[model samples]
Target chain A: MASPRPRTYAEAREVSSSNSELGWWVFMRISGLLLVFLVFGHLWTNNIVIDPATIDYDYVASRLAQPGVRIYDTFLLFFAMLHGVNGLRYSIEDYTKRPGRRFWYKILLYTVSAIIFVLGTMTLWAFTYQEMGDAVRAIGATQ
Target chain B: MYRGREGQWAFLLHRVSGVAIALFLLLHVLDISLVMFGPDGPFDAFLAFYHNWPFRIGLLMVIAGVVYHALNGLRIILMDFTTWGVRYQRQLWYGVLGLTTAIGVPVLWIVVPQIVGGI
Candidate 1:
């Protein structure tokens, strides 16, 4: 058995440009830039501007209750998961030598990613502050 | 994979950090989503558990992963788009390392104290 030659940079780019690979490549760059801003802003808000010590269940509930916060989080969740999932797919493709193995690996990845996304959406949007009020109060009192 | 050149190492680190961050995001989304289940549900319990020193250290690691992944990701984007980027890829990798260290040290400094202080 002989080792296969790797594609040259130009060859790889040419192939990518002919298919959805180009779109994903471009997406990684654009989404990467967006995530830098979104994730940092999220961290700064949660960790830097507000004291980390104050981040209890009540704090999170209150924050999530606001439409603005939920919207921001939705975008964050969407972008982060998509970007990360795509990156992982790229890695799996690179490392998985067998076609059958790669097929199953991607099936698992996509299935899990989809489930997470759906669960995340439901968690973010399904409950109202009124519904959460008692629990929030209970948690806050304990803390 | 075997070579230890700066570019090679940077690429390897970027991939590893990216995967780690992604896995963490999965857990994060699932955990935070517990909020919708109920305000005082497992989510609150999880948040309380997150207050421990070990968890704080884990968070520090997450921060480190984010810092490196973001910077190196920027480098990768630049290399892909700019005309002269490939020519200077090595230099860019070095810049990524330098920036990661410069930013990472201060981040750890600020975060570690808060964690240790039981914040």
Candidate 2:
């Protein structure tokens, strides 16, 4: 074998990941900032824009009937839920130390979070103005 | 003194409060989405149940959760950008806490009594 060539053919070494914790941290900061606007806008409209007393089925029906409101509400649900879950995930990760136990704990955490996320989304989709109206009529019928 | 740093505390509170608020968001959205079914039906029933005292306070807690989550979140972002070193951390957390209280007071003023009165 010719003595190690000037252009040595060395095996490439893969670098390990660093700053994983820092990356999550940056995410929290960015997500938190966006939440200020989304969350506040949601409250201003729901609680402040219209009086809560006026918030009957018809009121919400009209709100969801609008494309803009629907989109906005969908966004609020999507981002806030995601942001919240990620934050919680970080919490569980930080606190649970043992590798095997931590793995199980994370699985549990994700399962619960996923359930809530699914149910919440389904609830949003089930929004039905006509259904609300009929349900109102049925309630009145009983009286 | 070895006080927990500001950015770290803010991070902690933001996480805790965010979870609380997020849970509330799920429930609140579920509650509001009921109106899509119209005002007169199960929607009213769903809301009417919360007219009691305990539920009202519970709702207020939700509001508090929102205040804590949002304000602390803002602090985290600011500290992320600015050079808020360890020494200044506790002060920053206190600052956020004050801001949260300031914002929360008015919300309580409006939301609490209404819930208490079964609104």
Candidate 3:
């Protein structure tokens, strides 16, 4: 079984076993700090400022049309995805007893997460939401 | 590892909340990405489905998890970095729980009514 999580900075450095592991240990702390703000802001805007029930395609589209929202979401997406994916990896290591199962589970997790990450990035940057709505409207009229 | 105690409970809750939030984050990204399919796509339909009372309740739980996880995560950070952090770890945990509940009440007050009215 893997060693217990280190409780102190010195213990973390000594018990890390490798530079990459130490790096991840540090990364978790840094990312977690940033996510507190990012996630709370996201939740406040989406869930509290407006009634979530009224959020539709147009609502999201209009929001994404702003450059500021795009930038904010990009940071939120990057940090949250990396932090969350790594957290899941830690859980897999903790719970998955069999080595074979653990290996396959991580592979599957990374692959799916990578694809989803790409899709999310594309959604943020690939097309203008305003044009997307207009294009759909034009297509509907033509039909 | 720490066995049964307040610290242990704190650790257990942190892990459970972390894992739960991580899974939700993955699904959240995937669903939100549906917007790429354009305005006429299944984005609204999928959102409508989730806006149902059951899913709204689930979303509330996710929010709860996030609040707890975030506060406890700060506790963990403190324990790792500061000298007094470990000495007062138990009290820090109580603070975490207290703060989570403090934030949770207002959140529920805002969300519960929305859920009820949506139904």
The whole-model C-alpha lDDT of candidate 3 against the native structure comes to 0.90
**DockQ for each numbered candidate:** 0.51, 0.30, 0.73
Top candidate, metric DockQ: 3
Which numbered prediction scores highest in TM-score against the true structure? 3
Candidate 3 collision pairs: none
lDDT of each: 0.81, 0.64, 0.90
- Over B74-96, each residue of candidate 1 has an lDDT whose tens digit, in order, gives 88777766777777889998898
- Which of 1 and 3 is ahead in lDDT? 3
TM-score, model 3 to reference? 0.94
Relative to the unseen true structure, what is the C-alpha lDDT of residue B58 in candidate 1, on a scale of 0 to 100?
Answer: 85
Report lDDT (Cα) of residue A71, candidate 1.
95
* Residue-wise C-alpha lDDT for candidate 1, range A23-88, written one tens digit per residue: 676678889999999998998898767657657667878888789998999999999999999989
lDDT (tens digit, per residue) of candidate 2 on A37-142:
9888877787655546546655666677787877777777777777776776766766778889878877886786676666556545664566656766887789
Docking class of 2: acceptable
Task: Show pairs that collide, candidate 1.
Answer: none
> Candidate 3: misplaced stretches above 4 Å?
A1-4, A130-143, B1-3
Candidate 3 at residue B51, lDDT?
89
